[model samples]
Each structure stands twice: as C-alpha cells, then as structure tokens.
Target: MTQQTSGEMRIEKDSLGEIAVPAGHLWGAQTQRSIECFPIGTARFVWRRPVIRAFGILKKSAAIANGELGQLPADKVAMIVKAAQSVIDGDVDEEFPLVVFQTGSGTQSNMNANEVIANLAIRNAGGKLGSKTPINPNDDVNRGQSSNDTFPTAMHIAIVEEISRDLFPAVTQLRDTFERKGRQFDDVVMVGRTHLQDATPVTLQQVFSGWVAQLDEALAAITATLPALYALAIGGTAVGTGINAHPRFGDVTAAKIAAETGHAFISAPNKFAALSAHDAVANTSGAIRTLAGALMKIANDVRWYACGPRAGFNEITIPENEPGSSIMPGKINPTQCEALTMVAVQVFGNDAAVAFAGSQGNFQLNVFKPVMLHNVLESTMLISDACRAFDTFCAKGIEPNRAKIETNLKNSLMLVTALNPHIGYEKSAKIALLAHKEGSSLKEAALNLGFVTEQEFDAWVIPADMTHPLPE
Candidate 1:
C-alpha cells in the first residue's frame, strides 16, 4: 500500500492547532477551508464525540447488512465491521477531529469517522495508518452510507442516548425533591401572591406542588419525544435514494443501534421524508423549550420568594453559599436560584436557534447542522446543571420562614378570603378596602361595618380553612 506524505494534502490551523487531512478522504479540502474560514473560536459541538461514535455503529451495521445480502466480499466486510466495532466501543476518537461544522452536507464529519475507523482497523491488522491498500475510507469504511442520512440519523441516536442517560434523570431528581418538599410543608400556611401582591392564604405545600407539577409536565414532554428521535434515517444516502445500499440496510442498522445503545430504536418508515425533514429534532427542541419555560418560572418564583430577609418578602430562606453583596454586610441572596433562572433563559434562546435552523432546509437538506447540534447540546447541559444545582443548593436547604410567613399572613388585609363565603363579595371587598385605607385589622373593619358580631366573626373567619373548602 502506498502512503501519502503529510505535505501531500491540505493542512488547516485553528484553535486546536494544525490538522493534516489526506487527499483521499472526502473531507480534506472542505474541512481545511472551514477551519480557516470559521476561526470564530474553540466552540465546537459538545456532542461531537458521541455523534461520531454513532456513525461508526451505522457503518458497521451497514457493512453487516451488505454482506448478509451478498453485496460485499465476506472477508472485506468482516474487516470493516471489526474496525467499526472498535469505534462503537470507543476505541478510537483522536483521529476524528473534524468540527461538526462542515459545508459538504456533513460529508466531512462522515468521512472523518470513516477515515478514523478504517485507519484504526488497518493498524490493528498490522498495516500502517492511512494505508488504503486493504482498508479504504470509501470502499471499506463507508460501505453503505452517506453524510446526508448518517449525520442526522446519528445525531438523533446520540441525543436520545444523552437524554435517557443524563437529562431525564436529572429532571427526575428535581421533581422528587419538589415532591418531598411539598409533603414536608403540607401544613405550613403562608400568604399566596398573584401579580406580586398578596391575594390569599395558602399552605407552602401548594406552592411546592406547583413546581412539582411543572417538572412533571416537562418530563412527560421530553419522554414523549424520544420515540420520534429513535426513528433512524440511515440507508437514505446522499438524497434518501438508498443508492448502493441493500434493501434491508435501514432496518438492520436501526436494530444494531438499538442493541448497541440499549434503546428501542427503529428505522423511519419514510427514509426520504426523514432525510429531508428535521421535524424530529424540532419536536425535541420544542419539548426542551417547554421544560426551559417551566424551569424559568420555578426558578424565578424561588428567587423572588427568597428575595430578602429584610427588604423583600422573605417567605422562604435559601442557603447562603457566598456573600450576596460585597458592601452589604448581612445580605444573603438566592444565587443558585438565579443561576437556574439564567440557564433557563439560555435554554429558551437555544430553542429559538434550533427552531430557526430546523425551518431553513433547502430542497433535500438543512445546512444548519452545526448550529442545531450546538443549541440542542447547550440546552441539554444547561438543563442538567440547573436542575442539579437547584435541587442541591436551593430546594434541599430551603426552609419556610414560619415567623415571617405568619406575620405576613396576619398583616395581609387580603385575608378577606375568609370572609368571601360568609358576608358575600361586596361586603368583603368593602371591609378589605376600609381596613387597608384605615390601617385596621379585618376584625376592626368588620365591627365598624356591623357585618357580624365579634363572636360570630371569630367563629367564621378561619384563615387556615380559607385556602381550601372546610372539611365535611
């Protein structure tokens, strides 16, 4: 086998230093040019490794399918499958360094994986690296695939693996924490606010229950979209034509992926539709955005509720990890809650980016591959981190300020909730307004209005019973 010298191919320099690409690989010129053209930063896709590894799985499965159908030589298929298996098992990653950003419809990344796996197989078989004699990138490694189908298919598979492995579990932890908190605070009564003003009296349990409900809905949305992502687009090479691939390539590849990743993956019913449409990813991003919105609402409420031990409505006390203000001597702020809120906002923004990328498909493919992966991975990581942080730093240590809560409850003339069923809405409103205007208690305002005797008022106006219907 003839070996090409490093100087025989184009070289590109970027933040990761120089990468030498051989002329035989489809990615050589484009990756070289992209490195120089998009020298924006070291901002490469975070899930690139998993996606590339998934490509190796697809390649191996494709080879197995081809050989089973008698399309490739048995010995050659075995060698390629062996190499691809090494990659599937994470035996090689250093050689597949082409950024997820590429112009040849992800052909560069596809070839990067193919070249790396092929070379690894050759080296393992006692041949030199980059030797195209026995194992070649196109003829052997990429035996039955193309970037058009493989990239999106691998992306979907990788994201499903990530969500099942990481994102969903973290969210479950947060949900369980909220549930426990709800039960713990079941009887602790506090004033509930709407529009940032006291509206009625409610137990801290109800407030925590709201958070739990949001998390529950978010988890449902995320889990429901996993099936959509599990549908693979393999065998739809270049333009979903299955050009050179066996008829059963898609089904066989999907089964291999499911076995390899321990997920219930399947081939898309319409390879053409799958290759041309990114609706699966967009749906996934929509679920993520919904979760982000929920997280934002929960985090914002937590931060505001824990706002001040002195100036703000200090209903709940958050843990103090660091000094809140450098100048303020004794102020403790909701830093963890604030971090969660910020991450939620970033995830929302990422959803917008993903939506835009998903909508910009031209004819057969969307060129916004890098951006789509970027936003999805970013949202995943941020959601994971924020959920964990909120659980550990905020929810776990959070304590309802019983004294402050009772004080606010007593002082809030909005305790008119107790009178709603007794004296009717008009009289209750009049009493609340008079109390607020005259700086008097509900008892005083009611006595002045001749609404009820002191004994009857005391018997009927129960703050605890106002939050829910009285027990039968």
Candidate 2:
C-alpha cells in the first residue's frame, strides 16, 4: 500500500504517461475530475509558473500568520514555501496537468497548486506520499486564502513579472534600434507621402522618428497600467470581505509577495470590488492593444516602403535572407514585417477577447479567468517575440535606396521648401500646382513665374533642405 503524509496524494500516471497526484492532497479529486471532464484545449497553463508561485506565497504566508495567531507549528509555513519555490523554479512541471479549459473559474488551478505544494511539503518532512501527516491543504496549505482572491492576485503578479522581465525590455531595445537608425538617416532626403501621394520632401530620419514617437507612447501606456496591476486582491477571500481570513492577511501577504518578487505590489483597497471585477486585466489588455497598434503601424510602414524592387514603393530595400517563394524563384518577400503584422492582428483579437471576458463578470466572480489569462500571456509572449524578430530581421538589416530617394525627391512638386524662402505660401502653392499641371519641374515653374532667376531657383530648390523651416 502507498504510504501517505499530510497533503500527500498517491502518484498516478495519466494517459499521457505522465506522473501526477502523489496521494493524500485535497486537489486529487479536482485534478482527476478536470482531466476526465474538460479536455478541450490540448494546451496547458505551463508558463503560469509565476502565478502558481504567487498563489503558493500567499498560502504559506496565511498559514504562518494563522499558526502564529492560533494553533499550528512554526516550521509548516517554511516547508510549504520551499515546496512552492521548487515549482516556481521549474523543478517539477510534469507534476501539474490540468486542462486549460475548466469551469473558467480557475478553481481547479488553485486547487492543483494547493495540492502540489502540500504534497511536496509532506514529502520534505519525511512523510510518505498521499499522507496528510504534516501539512493539511485547508489548515496549512491554504490557510487564509480563497480561490477567488488568490486567482486574480496571482494573475496580476504573473503579468507584472513578465512585463518587467520580458516585454518592456524587448520594446526598449527595439525603440533604441529605431532611434539609432533615425540618427543615421538624418541627412538622407526622401519624398514624404500623404494619402499615397507625394506631398512633400522630408528626411528619412523624420519618417523613422514618427515610428519612434508611436513606440514611445505605447511604452508610456504600458507603464501607466502597471500600478493598477500592483494593487492585488489577496485578502478578498471568497467575495472580498476577508470572509474566513485574518483582517491583516491581505496586507501582510502582499508585503511578502512584494519582497519576494521585487515588485511593489499591495493589497487592493476594497477586497469586495476586486474579487468581483477584473479592471486590472482590462486595463493591461488596453495597454497591450496600444502596443499592437503601434507595432502594426510600424510594420505596415516598413512593408509598404519596401514593397517593390520593380513595382511597389521600392524606396527602401529589405535584406533578402532566404528565397521568399518556392515557385517564384528569386522572389523575396517582407516576411519579418509580415510576421510582425500578423502577430499584431492576433494581439488585437486577444484584446477584444479580454475585453469581452472582463465585461462578463457576474455578481461575486467572473468565470472567464482561464481565457483572460491565456490571452494576456499569449499577447505578452507574442509581442516580445515579434519585436525581437522585427528588430533583427527587418529593422536592423534595412537599407535606404539612395538612388530611389534622390529620384523621388527630384520628381516631387513639394520641393517648394526651397522656393518658400523667396516666395510666400500662396506663391509657393501656385508654383507647386503649375509644376504638377504642366508637367514641369519646380525650377521651370519658378522660371515661368519670373519670380526668381534660374540660378536663384536652382540654388534654392535643394530637396534635402526642404523639410525644415525656411531660413529667416
């Protein structure tokens, strides 16, 4: 017979040939039921280790506080915390195997974590598997926490960790790359486009600067949403009233979380409101949507600018890494930009899903936790990957077509910047219209106007200097 310890469950191999459920834990029934019931999405919540660990931290903190205040051993809290840290560090991923689709309430996930931590603690105390000898799931493993509060709190912690460790840094690197390119091309003149029509002359740097500005706005929006995420629903319990938990549990658990993660997370001001709502998730989703929009703009711009070797914009040439087409040999496509745009589109879709999920909250809780977490985490990972790929494959390797830039600049009627110094806006507009209507150059138009001498026209019509304010 399998020996049992407090919080330990008997180890059983699933159909996937994976070891799970070491006996004696409260989560065994739920995990087994989840495996048997909803097997919709093959994907598991594998990357949610941070969230799981956050749950573990809260549980351990509550247990310790409860033990100190009432009836339990001091070392029980340490055992649970150490067990949770092991899982957090990815030492035992196979131990968790719940379907991504459950009640959508995240109860299964919370229970799974409680069971795993409890069992690991029991084993650490030299107890046999499936035995709840040292750590009880309710009294010790999940002392002062409830799934309602723990789920959202853990979700916020996970998202914030990912944003700080991965998403923001990736965006910063990409932004720096664009800024460097902007400086590099500061002197390169190109025809500026409006409504797909040549409207004026501008430096390539100016065009790139527009992209940088958009990225900067995206970064700011993302940063602004972090504060909302930091305010967690730790002590909310079932419906945000500390129901069966200590009054100080939320604040103290949040403090422990902050200390462990190095992020300044705090308990929500109103536990009741937090447990019943998903404002943090919605706000963060908006930030991700903003990022997606910026990325879409940047990628579309690059693809359009790199469109043609013989037909499209052809103003800029993208580096050809591999043969773009199998059938059409020698054809190179904007694959990197295409990928980025595709990811942006997916992020937008995810944002919509998150919004809908967040809005569907019923009275005491929202049952859309699984979908919300999946989409949010997906958006984070995809954005990071797309930014890195775009930076390396598209942005870093981009080269301006100098001949094309010069030709487009020369052909544009908006070279009126040179004429603006001598003539006012109306006169410059007339000269531009005449140039376009009669198919004449700006110099010819100015000559016909008798506004300036040919030498004066030639000296003033420098396309490179047309983008800035005319000399005073």
Candidate number achieving the greatest lDDT relative to the actual structure: 2
How accurate locally is residue 390 in candidate 1, as Cα lDDT from 0 to 100? Answer: 82
| Alpha-carbon RMSD to native, per candidate | 4.4, 4.6
Residues 417-457, candidate 1, lDDT per residue (tens digit)? 67777789999999999999999998899999998789978
Question: Given candidate 1, what's the lDDT at residue 339?
Answer: 88
Clashing pairs in 1: none
lDDT of 2 by residue, 226-281 (tens): 99899988888888778777778788778877887899999999887677778888
